[model samples]
Target: MMRKQTPWLALALLTLAPAALAQKTKVDAPPKKLYCWNENGQRVCSDALPPEAVNYAREEISAKSGLRTGEVNRTLTAEERAQAAAEAAQRALDKAAEDTRRRTDQAMLMSYRTEDDLRRVFNERTAIVDNNVQTARYNVASLREGLISLLQTAGDRELSERPVSAEMTQNIRLRHAELVRQRQLQASFESQRGELDIEIEDILQRYRTMKGSLPADSAPAATTP
Candidate 1:
């Protein structure tokens, strides 16, 4: 015959039942999470990700909250990495080019007081190049005249039914080559003159732009031509 349970003991057991059940429910419940990723052009969702899906970009959501809590960025493929590297290199090259242009502009502004000053310097350079061209032209003419004389002599020998000597043949070849070279030199000098004109114009344009942006008091006075 068991003794009757005490009223206080019975009350305690009744009070503990709900707390014990709540603890058990919390332990037994699955973690609340939702993972989403792109697979084969479709969006897939699961409580956990597969090993293959680890390489794909994914988002983690709280199942209870239905909001994104975390993200995992995918690893880049070889092609994507290469493209990124190429773009980076091109950006570096562009930046370097821009820096060089800026420095050149600054230097130009510092060197020239006015557009006329710039033009005067370039004009002097052009005159020097013109003189070089004239000298080359004179040399070319002289060489051409010498080659023509050699050819005439060779023709005369041929008319007399005589073989042109090897020395004379060699001389003619040398003279002809010299004439060609002199003509090329003259053309090069002329090209330099043209390039100078283009360079001066470009400099003037940039200088004018920089000066125009300056305060009127700070800007240099324009010179008379």
Candidate 2:
């Protein structure tokens, strides 16, 4: 009653196993590329894409991009918006300081007799004027950024459309005050520079006059130490 196994039968079973598996398998088509050939033998671009591929390099790249774009569409939190505005204002302030320094240097160079003159004898009104201009630019950027954001949020909330706030009102007052101060400072510096230029011109004229009046036979006098 014991059954015997045959090697030829086992080999035949193995040969038929692959065919049975193939019958159970699903249909698979060749991968499609994203590009299409134009009538002129060139590829035309489109937003749509083709079917899946083995490499999927392009699809992986697109997946990352989609994630980034989704992030972009997501709303900025209140804290984030405020922080961004503050950082922008800080950067503007730093640049204003740099601008003021450069303007002060240029103004002093134009009117000053020596490097020491900037600190010693020369006027400092131009530096005040430059400070005003830089301050104005800074305020403009800061205020505009804040206003735009506020207006955008207000529109989103469907609140009153007018762009106004206590902070903005205070900024406006400061801006006017700075403008007036800048004008007065500029006037003072300009008048001082004018006076200095006249003095230099008179000195040069007198020197020429004295040289023309000198006698040809006179010997030059040497200075004693």
Task: Residues 77-179, candidate 2: write the lDDT tens digits.
Answer: 6897899999999999999988996685444334544334333432354465456556655655665566566556656555665666677666656655665
Reference-based TM-score, model 2: 0.28
**Model 1 residue 220 lDDT score:** 54
Worst 10 residues of 1 by lDDT: 216-225
Poorly placed runs, candidate 1 (over 4 Å)? 1-97, 220-225
lDDT of 1 at 115: 76
Tens-digit lDDT track of model 1 for 1-225: 999876998799999999999999999997689999999999999998889898999999999899999998998999999999999999999999999999988776766787777777776778889899899999998998899999999999999999999999999999998888999999999898888778878878888899889887776544445
| Candidate achieving the largest TM-score | 1
Clashing pairs in 1: none
Q: Give the TM-score of each candidate.
A: 0.55, 0.28
